[model samples]
Target: MGVFTYENEVASVIPLTKFFKAFIIDADNLYPKIVPNQPQTEIVEGDGGPGTIKKITFNHGGQVKIIMHRLDIVDEASLTYKYTVLEGDLISDTIDQIVKEIKVTAGPDGGSILKNTSIYHIKGDNQLDKEKLKTDEEKGLTLFKIAAGYLLTNPDEYN
Candidate 1:
């Protein structure tokens, strides 16, 4: 198997604690509320914690496609979360799985800094598409920023 990894950092105006609570603790309930134009999400199994599984279905002109993610870690004190994409249309034929880790820390201006790491495990000698990976990272950063905006505007929503 081959492993490919990348890191991305996103800075937000929202506070670190609030960002962590909104994105990590309350994502299952907050995502659809904040991102109505994106895919619809549901917790198909477990209760939104370590070992919990979530299914996200995209509405593509009534043709629905799905992706499954399993939460692997949730650490409140450290403001960290980790999950793995067990099944998804985005996974290539040679890709086994994708593991993602996110850490939220206090920024210089009382906001938050998000650190994201993605590891792609591929089977055999297959090579990952770097452009696609970059695109995915960009998309994730956008989503995080949107969530941060939502939390900043509605301070009491997540808490």
Candidate 2:
């Protein structure tokens, strides 16, 4: 029942609406380009829009492998993405279930608020250490910032 949240954020020179419209809404394509090592993230069983399903296959910790399906997408006003880890890696069997959710909103000073919450299951006498989780998440999210930085600076190049 313990919950962990991780946030990856950057101040876009562009408007918050534009950042939310592009990055969060069209994440499947953008995320892969932004962070390639984590997931292949191809549209497999469905289209690119809402209700589409994609298979995400990637390596974890060199010894662990993972495959997951992204389920639904809600983009009425803000974006709320739901997914399940169909297959998991070696880090934690506690990951009986896993999901990453992002809640984007217009922030003060014309910035965007990118809030992420990850739900995962862990089992056995041993549990995930906080530092490990934070380090791993920070690395992955840092990549997102890197890509976003490039896009914000050279808007048309990656658009």
Candidate 3:
């Protein structure tokens, strides 16, 4: 299998702890509430820590799409989280799996820096679809913005 990795960083005015808590710790509960179009997440197995598996279902273009991801790492002390998408509608025949890592750090001016890395494992010699990758990245950023907006409006929610 072939692999491709992409990295990006986003700066947010929200504090590191608050952002991490809202975006990583409470995402399953917060996303659907804050963003009406967000996916519904349910823990399928294990606790919320490492090795946990979550099933996420969402509506896309009048169709339902479900994705299952397993938690690889969840470190509250360092504000780091990693998960791998093992199965889902999002995984095409050319893709074996997708691993995502996120780290939140204290940025200047009491803000936070979100660093993201996505590793795509291909099934064969097919080239990675740049359009799909960009669309996924945009969707991720949109979710981040929605969570940040919610946290900003309700400062005491994640604190």
Which of the two candidates, 2 or 3, achieves a greater TM-score against the reference?
3
Q: TM-score for all predictions?
A: 0.89, 0.71, 0.93
Cα error, residue 37 of model 1, in Å, equals 4.1
Cα lDDT tens digits, model 2, 71-152, are 6566646656555555546235555556777666667786666666776555445467778777777665674476568568
Best by TM-score: 3
Model 1 steric clash pairs: none
User: Which residue pairs in candidate 2 have backbone atoms (N, alpha carbon, C) closer than 3 angstroms, thus clashing?
Assistant: 94-121, 94-122, 94-123, 95-121
Q: Report RMSD (Å) for each prediction in the order shown.
A: 2.3, 3.7, 1.6
From the highest lDDT down, the ranking of the candidates is 3, 1, 2
Q: Model 2: residues >4 Å from true position, as ranges?
A: 1-13, 32-39, 48-51, 58-66, 124-126, 157-159
In terms of lDDT, the best-performing candidate is 3
Cα lDDT tens digits, model 1, 1-159, are 999999989898888988898888877677777676567778889977789898998764432277798999999999999999999775768889999999998998898999999999998999887997798678768779888778877877755
